[model samples]
Target: MLANADHVMPDELKFEGDKAFFFAALDRADLIVHGRNSYEDQPNSPKRRRIIVTRKVGAVARDTENPNATLWNPHGAAFEAARAQAGVHTGTVAIIGGPDVFDMFMDRYDTFFLSQAPRVRLPGGEPCFDGVPARSPEQVLAAHGLKAAESIILDPAFDVSVTAWRRDNASSAARR
Candidate 1:
């Protein structure tokens, strides 16, 4: 949840501490997935395979600028097919999301890394999750049967921290 309450991710919300933590994690992912509006902040990372979820494309289409990226529409094409189109046959999938994209993958994530900048508050800005502001992001995650791991402080200077959420064995079994 990287935006303000108004569902807009303003430029001012980007925190350097969060980026360091986020980019490092992205390095371990085989494929990155995000909504059209949600993009990787690193522009220089070369050819990172990704899927851009969008409504503009009927199902799946090649991204104009990046050959490693495929535009996918959930309503038109199955996510499995899109993942394949992104050239990731197997390995971990990373979701860097906007609220709708996060909501779409509720059942599929093995882990969710939620980072917060405690000192910065966007009163009328976007919520991390769609149900946020109404029910906190933590509440939404709990409702989805995800258990939180210990929170780690990423950057003390900016007061940024991250928590990892994973479904318990029982919850995973139920999901399967």
Candidate 2:
């Protein structure tokens, strides 16, 4: 499990099919969003533009290290502003997770891709979403108004499957 908040992904959690699916989606995205803690060094990661959610800055700021990355604090500035800062005008936005970051965008997500690894269990490990272990990721997504679509098996060997939980826009509109 995690020795700290940003420990490397353990071998048990790695899924070849999931990685392929995720990176393919990311390749189609114009902008990517994730928390500082979830920063992963992919083969062409720096080549992809992204917005890094962090409290280190009060508002949107240019990432000193990566020219393609922008640091944003959702509390201080609007997402559109951050998007512009990240040079993403029109395209898909891929959100990589680390619990708190996913929670921040929970309400706005149109479709949440959930990959379940049934065999992998970490009693005290960090959850994919907040209030996990007790509430479960599915519960949290359902609580946030998302309904699962169809389950796609990523890896039959590992029994890893992914489901796209779509937000009910009609119900959301009524709630608003």
**Clash-forming residue pairs, model 2:** none
lDDT of 1 at 54: 90
Alpha-carbon shift of residue 66 in model 1 (angstroms) = 1.2
Off by over 4 Å in 2: 1-7, 169-176
lDDT of 1 by residue, 1-176 (tens): 47765666666657677788788888988998898677776764556898999998999989988888899999999998998788788888889888788989987777888887777778777677877788988898888878799788878887788999998777666664
Best model per lDDT: 2
Taken over the whole model, the C-alpha lDDT of each candidate is 0.82, 0.83
